[model samples]
Target: MLAPFLIMLREGVEAALIVGIIASYLKQVGRSDMMPAVWLGILTAVALALFVGTGLQMVSAEFPQKEQELFEALVGVVAVAVLTSMVFWMRKAARSIKGELHASVDRALSGSAFALIAMVFLAVAREGLESVFFLLAIFQQSNDALAPLGALLGVAAAVVIGYGIYAGGVRLDLRRFFRWTGVFILFVAAGLLANAVKAFHEAGLWNGLQETAFDISHILPADGPLGSLLSGMLGYRDAPTVGEVIVYVVFLAATLIPFLAPASPATSRAAARPARQKV
Candidate 1:
C-alpha cells in the first residue's frame, strides 16, 4: 500500500506540474480562452488511460494460469523498461521543460484548434499511459485491493500539493524531490526486473536456472509487512532464484552507475541557477 502510494504520488505530481506550467504560461500570455481545450484534452487522456487499464485487466483475467503468468511477466518487464526510461528522461529534460512546453504551446496556438487539442492530448496521454502501465505491474505483484486505494490517495495528495505550488502557496525543492524519488524508483524497477524473470521461469519460458541463491525466508518472509514493502519498493525477495538475483544485481549496477555519475558542468550550472535565484 505504501509503495503504490508513493509511486502514484510521484507520478501524479509530475503530471500536475506539467499541466500547471502550461496553464500558468497560458494565463501569463493572455491566452486564457484556450484553457478549455487543454482541459478537454486532459480529460480525454484520463478516460483513455482508464479504459485501457480496465480492458487489459479484463482480457488478462480470461487467460489460463500459465498464460496469465506470462502476461504478467510481460507487463512487468514493459513497465520496468518504461519507468526506467521515464526517470532518466525526466532528469535530462527537467532543465529545459519549461522552454519546450512554451514552444509547443506557441506552435499549437498558431495551428488549427485540432492541432492544439492534439498537443494537449499527447502531453497528458503520455503521462497517463505511463501511470496505467506502472499501476498494472504493481497491481499484479500486490494482488491486493488496498494498493489501488492507496494510489488514489496518493494522486489526491499530489493534486493538492501541485495546486499549492502553482498557486504560490507552497515552495518545494523540486530538484531534491525528484532526485530522491528517482533513486527510489530505480530500486523499484530493479525489483520488477527480478520478478519478471521469476514469472518467466514459472511460465516455462526460461529453464535450468531455477536454483535458489539463498533462503532468508526464516529471517524476512516476503509476505510480511516490512518484507512486502521492501519487496514492492526494492525487490527484496527472501529466497530469490539465482536468475532473479543475477538480474536484480545487473540491472541495479548498470543503471545506478551512470545515474550517480556527475552531471555535465553546464547542466549543473543551469540546475543551480533556479535555486540560487529563488534563494
Candidate 2:
C-alpha cells in the first residue's frame, strides 16, 4: 500500500512539475493563450494511462496459472527497468530540466500548435506511464484494496503540494526530497527485481537454482500483518530462492553504488542551489 503511494507521489510531482514549467513558460512568453493546449495534453495523457492500466488488468484476469506467473514476471521486470531508468533520469535531469523545458517551449511556440501539444503530452505521458507500470507491478504482488486507496491519497497530496508550489505558498527543499526518495526507490526496485526472479522461476522459465536461501517463515510468516507489510514494501520472502537473493544483491550493488557515490562539483552545486518553481 505504502509502495504504490510513494511511487505515485513521486511520479505525480514529476508530472505536475513538468506541466507547471510549461505553463510558466507560456506565461513568460505571453503565449498564455496556448495554455489550453497544455491542458489538452495533460488530459489526454491521463486518459491514456487509465485506459492502458485498465486494459492490462482486464487482460491479466484471463491468463492461466502458468501464464499468469509469466505475465507477472514480465510486468515485474518491466516495472523494475522503468523504475531504475526514471530514478537515474531524474537525477541527471534535475539540474537542467528548467532550461530544457524553456528551450522546448521556445521551439514549440515557434512551431505549429500540434508541436506544443505534443511537447506537453510527451512529458506528462512518460511520467504517467511510469506510474502505471509501478502500480501494476505492485498491485499484482499484493492485490490489496488499500493499495489503490493509498495511491489516491498520494496523488491528492501531490496535487495539493504542486498547487502550493505554483501559488508560491510552499517552500520545499526539492533536491533533498528527491535525493532521499531516490534512495528509497532503489530499495523498492531491488525487492521488485528479486520478486521478478522468483516469478520467472515459478513460471518455469528459469530453473537454475532451486535451493532455498533461508526460511524465516517460522518467525515471520509472509501472511502475518507485519510480514505482509514488509512483503509489500520490501518484497519480503520468508523462504527466498537463491536466484532471488542473487538478483536482489546484484541490482542493489549495480544501482546503489553509483547512486550513493559523491556527486561531481557541478552536480553538487546544482543540488545545493534553491529549487526554482515558477508558475
Candidate 3:
C-alpha cells in the first residue's frame, strides 16, 4: 500500500512539476496562449498511459497460470527498469531541466502548436508510463485489495502538493525529499527484481539453484499483517528460494552502493540547486 503511494506521489509530482514549469515559462515569455496546447498534450499522454495499462491488464486476465506468471515477470522487469531510470535520470536532469524546457518552449513558439503539444506530450508521457508500469507491478505483487486505493490517494496528495508548490504555498526541500525517496525506491526495485526472478522460476522459465534460502514461514507468514507489510514494502518472502535471496542482496549491493556514493562536483552543484517551482 505505502509502496505504490510513494512511487505514485514521486511520479505525480514530477509530471506536475514539468507541467508547472512549462506553464510558468509560457507566461514569462508572453506566450500564455500556448498553455492550452500544453494541456492538450498532457491529457493526450495521460490517455495513452491509461490505454496501455488497461490493455495489458485485460489481456493478462485471460492467461493461464504459468503464462500469467510470465506476464507478471515481464511487467516486473519493465517496472524495475522504469523505476531505476526515473530515479537516476532525475538526479542527472534536475539541473538542466528548466533550461531544456525553456529551450523547447522557444523552439515551439517558433514553429506550430503541434510542436508545443508534442513537447509536453512526450515529457508528461514519460512520467505517465513510468507510473503505469510501477503501479501495475505493485498491484501484481500485492494480495491486498486496498493497494489501488492507496495509490489513488497518493496521486491525489501529490497533485495537491504539486499545486501547493506551484502556488507558492509549499516550501519543501525537494532535493532531500527525492534523496530519501530514491533510497526507498532503490530498495523497492531490488525487491521487484527478486520477485521477478521468483516469478520466472514459477513460470518454468528459469529453474536453477532451487533450494530454500530460509524458512520463517511458520513465524512470519507472507500473508499476515506484519509479514505482508514487509513483503510488499521490502519483498520479504518467508521461505524465499535461494535464487531470490541471491538476486535481492546482489541488486541492493550493486545499486545502493553507487547511489549512496559521493557525486561529482558538477552533479553535487546541480543536485544542490532546488527545483524552481514558484512563478
Candidate 4:
C-alpha cells in the first residue's frame, strides 16, 4: 500500500506540474481561449490510460497460473526499466522543464488548433502511459484492493497540491522533492527487479541459480505483513534465491551510486539561483 501510494503520488504530481505549466503559459500569453483544448487533451489522455490499464488487467487475468507468473515477470521488468529512465530523465530535464514547456506552448499556439490539441495530448499521454505501466506492475505485486485504494488517495492528494500551486497558495521545492522521491523510486525498482527474477524462476523460465542464498524464514517469513511490506518496497526476502539476491543488490548499487553522488558545483549553483530568485 505504501509503495503504490508513493509511486502514484509522485507520478501524479509530475503530470499535474506539466499541465499547470502549460495552463499558466497559455494564460500569460493571452491565449486563455485555447484552454478548453488543453483540458480536452488531458481528459483524453486520462481516458486512454484507464482503458489501457483495464485491458491489461483483464488480459492477464485470463492466463493460466504459469502464464500469469510469466506475465507478471514481464510487467515487472518493463516497469523497472520505465521507472529507472523516468527518474534519470527527470533529474536531467528538471532544470529546463519550465523553459521547454513555454517553448512547447509557443509552438502549439503558432500552429493550428489541431496541432495544439495534439501537442497537449502527447504531453499528458506520456505521463499517463507511465502511470498506467507502473500501476500495472504494482498491482501485480500487491494483488490486494488496498494498494489501489492507496493509489487513489495519493492521486487525490496530488490534485489538491497541484491546485494549490496553480492558485498561488503554495510553493514547492521541486528539485528537492523530485530528488528524494527519485531515490526512493530507485529502491522500489530494485525490489521489482528481484520480484521479476523470482517470478521467472517460478515459471521455470530460468533455473541456473535456484539455491537459497540465505534463510531468514525463522525470523521473518516473506508472507508476514511486515515482511511483505519490505518485500514490496525494498525487495526483502526471507530465503531469497541466489539470482534474486544478485539482481537486487547489483541493480540497487549501480543505480544508487550515481544517484547519491553530490551534484556538480555548476549544477548546484544553477539550482540555487532559482530558489534565491524566488526568495
Candidate 5:
C-alpha cells in the first residue's frame, strides 16, 4: 500500500505540475483562450493511459501460471528501467523544465492547434504511462486487495496538493520534496529489482545462487503488521534467495551513493542555466 501510494503520488504530482505550468505559460502569453485545447489534450492523454493499462492487465490475466510468472518478471524489469530513467531525468530536467516548456509552447502555438494538443499530450503521457507501469508492478507484488484504493488516494492527494501549489495556497520546496522522495523511490526500486530476479527464477529462467540467504520469519513474519509494511514498501522477505539479496544490496549501493551525493559545481551551474535551443 505504502509503495504504490508514494510512487503514484510522485507521478501524479509531476503530471499535475506539468499541466499547471503549461496553463500558466499560456495565460502569460495571452493564449488563455486556448485552455480548452489544453484540457482536451490532458484528458485524451489520461484516457489513453487508462486504456493501455487496462488492456495490459486484462491480457496478462489470461496467461497460464508459468507464463504469468514470466510476464511478471518482464513487467518488473521494465518498471525498474522506466523508474530509474524517470528519477534521473527529473533530477536533471527540473532546473530548466519551465524554460524548456515555454519554448515548446511557443513552437507549438506557431504551428497549429493540433500541435499544442500534441505537445501537451506527449508531455503528460510520459508521466501517465510511467504511473501505469508502477501501478502494475505494485499490484502484482501486493497481497492485499486495497492496494488499488491506496494508489487512487495517493493520486487524489497529489491533485489537491498540486492545486494548492498552483493557487499559491501552498509553498513547497519542490527540490527538497523530490530529493527525499527520490531516495524513498530508489529504495523501492531496489526491492523491485530483487523481486524481478526472484520472479525470473520462479519462471525457470534463472537458477544461480538459489540457496536461501536467511530465515527471519519467526522474528518478523510477512503477514505481521510491520513485516507487511516493509514487504509492500521495500520487498522484504523472511527468507530470500542469495541472488535476491545480492541484487537488492547491490542495487541500493549503486543507486544511493550517487543519488545522495551533492552535485558538482559545474553540474550545478549547467542545471541552473536555461537551454540555448528553443526546445
Candidate 6:
C-alpha cells in the first residue's frame, strides 16, 4: 500500500507539473483560448493509460500458472527498469523542465491545433504510462486490498499539490522533494529487482544458483503484520534465495552510489536558477 501510494503520488505530481507548465506558458503568451486543447490532450492521455492498464491485466488473467509467473517476472523487470529511468531522468530534467516545456509550448502553438494536443498528450502520457507499469508490478507482488486505496489517495494529494502550485497558494522546494523521493524509489526498484529474480527462479527460467541465503521465517515470517508491510514496501523476504539476495545487494550498491553523488555542475546551476528567481 505504501509502495503504490508513493509511486502514484510522485508520478501524478510529475504529470501535473508538465501540464501546469504548459498551461502557464500558454496564458503568458496570451494563448489562453487554446486551453481547451490542453484539457482534451490530458483526457485523451488518461483514457489511453487506463485502457492499456486494463488490457494488460485482462491478458495476464488468462495465463496458466507457469506462464503467469513468467509474465510477472517480466513485468517486474520492466517495472524496475522504467522506474529507475524515471527517477534518474527526473533528477536530470527537473531543473530545466519549465524552460524546456515552455519552448515546446511555443513550437506547439506555432503549429496546428493537433500539434498542441499532441504536445500535451505526449508529455502527460509518458508519466501516465510509467505509473501504469509501476502500479502493475506492485499489484502483482501484493494482493492487499489497500493497494488501490493508497493509489487513489496519492493521486488525489498530488492533484491538490499541483493545483496549489498553479494557483500560487503554496510554495515548496521541489528540488528537495524530488531528491528524497528519488532515493525512496531507488529502494523500491531494488526490491523489485530482487522480486524479479525470485520470480524467474520460481518460473524455472533460472535454475542454477539455487540456494537459500538465510531463513528468518522462524523469527519473523514475511506474512506477519510488520513483515508484510516491509515486504510490500522494501521487498523483504523471510528466506531469500542466494540469487535474490545477490541481485538485491548489487542493485542497491550500483544505483544508490550514483544517485547519492553530488549533482553535476550543469545540474547544480539549473537547480539554483529557480531559487534565485523570487516566485
Per-residue lDDT for 1-279 in model 3, tens only?
A: 888888888998888888888888898889888889998999999999999999999999999999999999999999999999888888777766777787788888899999999999999999999989988888898776778988898889989998898888998787777877888999999889889998999999999978998999999999899999988887788998899989989988988788777689987666545434321
TM-score of each predicted structure versus truth: 0.94, 0.93, 0.94, 0.92, 0.97, 0.95
Flag regions of model 3 displaced more than 4 Å: 269-279
Clashes of 1: 0
Candidate 4, pairs of clashing residues: none
In candidate 5, which residue pairs get closer than 3 Å at backbone N, Cα or C atoms, i.e. clash? none
lDDT (10s digit) by residue, model 1, range 92-165: 77776777777788888898777767888888888888888888998887655688888899899999989998
For model 2, residues 1-279, the per-residue Cα lDDT tens digits are 898788888888888888887887788888999999998988999999999999999999999998999999899899999999998888877877887788788889889888999999899899888888888889888756799998998899888888787777988777777777888888888998888888888898989877999999999999889898888888888999888889988999999989878789987677535334321
lDDT of each: 0.84, 0.85, 0.87, 0.85, 0.87, 0.87
Q: What TM-score number comes out for model 1? A: 0.94
lDDT of 4 by residue, 13-86 (tens): 88889888888878888999999999888898899999998999999999999999999999999889989988
Off by over 4 Å in 2: 266-279
Q: How much is the lDDT of residue 77 in candidate 3?
A: 94
* Predicted structure 5: lDDT: 0.87
Model 2: ten consecutive residues of lowest lDDT: 270-279
Backbone clash count for every predicted candidate, in the order shown: 0, 0, 0, 0, 0, 0
Task: Give model 4's TM-score versus the native structure.
Answer: 0.92
Model 6 TM-score is 0.95
Model 6, 1-279: lDDT tens per residue? Answer: 898899888988888888888888788889999999999999999999999999999999999988898989999998999999998898887877787777677788888989999989998898888888888888998866798999999999999999988888989688888888899999899888888887888888998666999999989999999899988888899999888888989998998899879898887897657534522
